[model samples]
Target: MAPNNQTLGNNELGAWRIFSLFMLLIQKGPLPSAEIYAAIYSDLSTDSALRTFSRDRTVLKQLGFAITEVKTGKEKSFYLSDSNFFNSSYDLSPEDANQLLVICSAILTDATFVYQEELRNALSKIVGNFYSLESGKSDSQKLSASSQNKVFPVLYESLSSKQLVNITYTNSQDLVKQKHLGVLDFFVSQRLLYFVAQDFSSGTESASIKTFRVDRVLDAAILKNESFSIPEEFDSKDYKLLDFQLGLQADTLTAFVPKNILAAFEHFSQGQGDVELLSNGALWTVTYAHEDTALSWILAHGLIPRSPESLLAKWKGSLSEVANGC
Candidate 1:
């Protein structure tokens, strides 16, 4: 055997076999331990192996295997108990697999974060394993699309080490803005990475840090500029994604969503805000953070404003003006 594969005692062999069987049980869902042992180690019949098998059973139970004891006073046995293990399929779903592929594509194309190469390799390994399983499947049925996996693993390491980065970045408005941006901190929520960028231009009084979505980044390069410490005042723990107000300038926007729109209140009151249900039963009083994305989303629904002819007429006129402009 190779150096990696040393001679195994009967007990070690039993433990290894049991571990493999446990993974199969998780994939196949809810099997009595006895059934699992029989399925994987039916050929093994030795005293030491049986003793090792008993110990492995206890170890597996402690490792969150959802194993529970089943007893009817006279008979007792252990069985797999978790129901969630059956969810999301033994393999990745078509939709979720596709979503990961898209994310990989975006990461490849994005030029912001400096950790793409390393993370992309890791992500690709996961994706490659998935595709390798579908060897005989048709090309159309497989995830064969190519993306660059545009993450800057090198730049990411620099940020992680508290080193400074220099890059020309455009502001949110899509202008040709260039400046050295210091990466203060990095955090992720809901699978989106946020880079806290601080302006590092001279002649500017002070630097102000702002969050940028990693996916939208154009490019990043590590600068030889002096390194800076992240401010203690900045606490990402208290930060919430919806708290940042972007776009539309409105204290409140009154709109109507059809009853069929699922979880309208949950969608509207994402951040810290109050949503009041109007008395008329048709409209919802939504007090939001006056964000552009939220407003555009609400406007995109093309909800008709309610009652009081003047308000309705104003909205109609606004719509007509926007339509003519478009």
Candidate 2:
């Protein structure tokens, strides 16, 4: 057992040594093989180290490191061709570093931001390396756990591992229910976190794919043994909470938006619409699922539907009913 443990330790060290060699070559490159072996393995005989390095070169190439070799006379020089490895050489100027420090300071001090502690810690580490930045001070007005939704990390893990989870969810109507979900993807919109997932339990009258507000989740338990895969056709980009519909089919909505609401609409649509600025407002054409939620948004915003006679007639009927009730 002792010998086996020692072997395992040696294997781990060997792997790290190989990675270090890659990083060294990436930082200071086009070096001859003799020089690389001398820098990394001074303890080994020159001939033996050269042979081992030559074999490791093939291993690095197979791992997609983009190692390039250039021949000069009887010697071969090697370097990493990936631009990302060389980005560290481009150091930020003092002015740029100061600007980053200011921005990070502002964000770190703001308690309203989501993941505020995590963001502040990350920024502190980065800024600390360049300039002396003060540690984050505790705020008296820190957000409560309920408002922060502590379930974010659990949902993130479920989504990453493709695991199924049992969730106690509070619906829009304030009804509480339990559900088994195969986590798919997550996104934030309108300062709210939402998950796009597949319902695995029975009595799902709607589409199998649906979205759930993370904040409304009262409890979640990950099912480690139960794993699921997302459908090949499902794309998270096609679905958005702002669109007000979860259905896969969509129809083009043409309307004139007021100048005040144009920016809000653009934020929700994520620049997925065609807009032409007019003297009074903007003429916009965007795609949305033909659902009650979509119709309600158009009515709420007092938008005039420019196409689809059925939709126009429905909108008129809705207004008539509202006026009659009043």
Candidate 3:
């Protein structure tokens, strides 16, 4: 009825007329039939244009446009009230909702969860729709999903209950050892859960919480009798130097990385530093640690970190040359 090409002189109402009327109401908000047709119907000058558009509304209703009236007035107006995009029952802020979507996307890269595709698709659709509402904002986060099923509860409950656990763990130096450890805290770092522990090799002794990879733990048994105190003075975040224990005599050293790599570097170092950007664009500095974990971390990140060339690299390079048959 509203001057659309498909509606002029047609005995039966066309689908395009109904679709255009619905889109007009959605985009421009509610309007009465006279205003709606005057805005869109080219046949408004014709004799039967009003009756034709009224029939079009009936066609739209049959096609599922749950259009509702705004008020009981001389001029009746209508709008879409049942649209999925306009619904407000979903509970999530635009940003966190999108973040949850990204988490779903990144997890799909893992082959371990392929069998649960139906559940994954449902979550994906929900999150994808949620993300669509917050499109064009940059809040990107990348994380790898664990191959194992839920492990946080085991670690969290063990630490909260003050239980001692026996586990086979590999330290930063790749040295695997089996020992009884008292749980101090459970935390997620870089998307992996770590259990902070104290060595229970001897008597009831208080020690700094040394982090153990939760995934690598071969076995966990709760020892009900043992208990220990985490020093009030000890700060979990700043004690990287003071708290480290590799079963080796504690000592100090310096490590550095380029400023761009400083974020990964901070994971292994204390807060203090006077690092200088060298002419070659690498960082040079000092740190203190009892074990080679700090160095190994840098190497693992492929950041090419080095101790003083005179102390560590000269011998390392010599070994490299000999291994190369030079």
Candidate 4:
């Protein structure tokens, strides 16, 4: 077994599977599922391996990895950075590179959903070391300060102290609204920094959490008069993904899953969707903001998709591309 997959458990709940997948995808090129399964789950059969791989892929999606499918007629092959985004030289431009820098800065300070602060710090320095070959040390300093979101430090302090905050936020529609939030998770996705919080100022029951884009925040002031704490019963991880789907202009997607893989599919789509029992098989409806993401997952898993003409067209387009390539 590879060193990466050795210690991770054999089940879907083993989060290390995600790191394992990363290690696999970061290798010498696009790899088919058969090879990936062989490398990560050498002891398990293909059916058994897909169960865990599906869950790991779900985690990757949550973390904003754009896993692309490159294939011929034989099998689907996954290539992590199709746009060469991973190999691009370090720059100060306010684009994807800048977004990565912003994320690195936040992970170095805030409590995270997956990686630890120390781990993230190590990754930042490692990437910095790589970038040093081209640029100098001063560029690295610029990298840290490049997180131009002015409200970031206050949000970090708010989470650290369990303090409440009043934020004037602009939604996707560009309508600005005021919210008093208990800052929970501050992280980045698809090149934007977002935070999940309990909205104390909402008119609804306020039982559910909400995600907000930090850059969209017009102003943020920590409410010194109020403090908040998460109850022992509340699990932020469970709600974070679903709220993120809602936070974006996410669309609903329904698909059919074979009985053989239904359990794994259900587990994989956790936090963002649900399953319906049917006489024939099972149906899964997922809320996602990115079309490429949905297409990649569907291709990677070999699931039968039913809705959202855009996705189906893209899925067919993927197959047609492969066919044309052959």
Per-model lDDT: 0.50, 0.62, 0.50, 0.61
lDDT-better candidate, 2 vs 4 = 2
Model 1 poorest ten-residue lDDT run: 142-151
- Tens-place lDDT digits, model 2, residues 100-129: 444333333233333444543343344333
What shift in Å separates residue 120 of candidate 4 from its native position after superposition? 14
Window of ten residues with lowest summed lDDT in model 4: 128-137
lDDT of 3 at 292: 53
How far residue 53's Cα lies from its native spot in candidate 2, in Å, is 28
Overall local distance difference test of candidate 4? 0.61
Q: Model 2: how large is the Cα RMSD against the reference? A: 16.4
Q: Please write out the lDDT profile of model 1 over residues 70-135, one tens digit for every residue.
A: 663554555567653233334554454445544444334334433445554554444434443333
TM-score-better candidate, 3 vs 4: 4
Looking at candidate 2, the ten consecutive residues that score lowest on lDDT are: 128-137
Looking at model 3, residue 278 earns an lDDT score of: 64
The TM-scores, one per candidate, come to: 0.39, 0.41, 0.35, 0.45
Of candidates 3 and 2, the better by TM-score: 2
lDDT of 2 at 64: 52
- Model 4 TM-score, 2 decimals: 0.45
- lDDT by residue (1-326, candidate 3, tens digit) is 42232323342235334545655776655777567767557656645667766677665565445567676477777767666333344355555443443333333323333322443434434443333223332333211122112233334334545566666654556577777776665433333334566877555465545666555554445667765556677565542323223235444344446667666555544453456666544454545343455444444554554554443664466458879999
Per-residue error (Å), model 1, residue 170: 3.0
How well is each residue in 1-326 modelled by candidate 4, as lDDT tens digits?
32323342343225344555675676546888778877677767778787867767665655556577777578988768756434324333325444444444433333423344334444434433223222322443222332323355566556756788888776768687888888777544444445778888864544457777665565677999688877567775555463225445557788888888777876656545677888777887878776677777777776777888888888778888999995
List candidate 3 segments past 4 Å from native.
1-152, 168-178, 186-193, 238-284, 288-307, 310-326
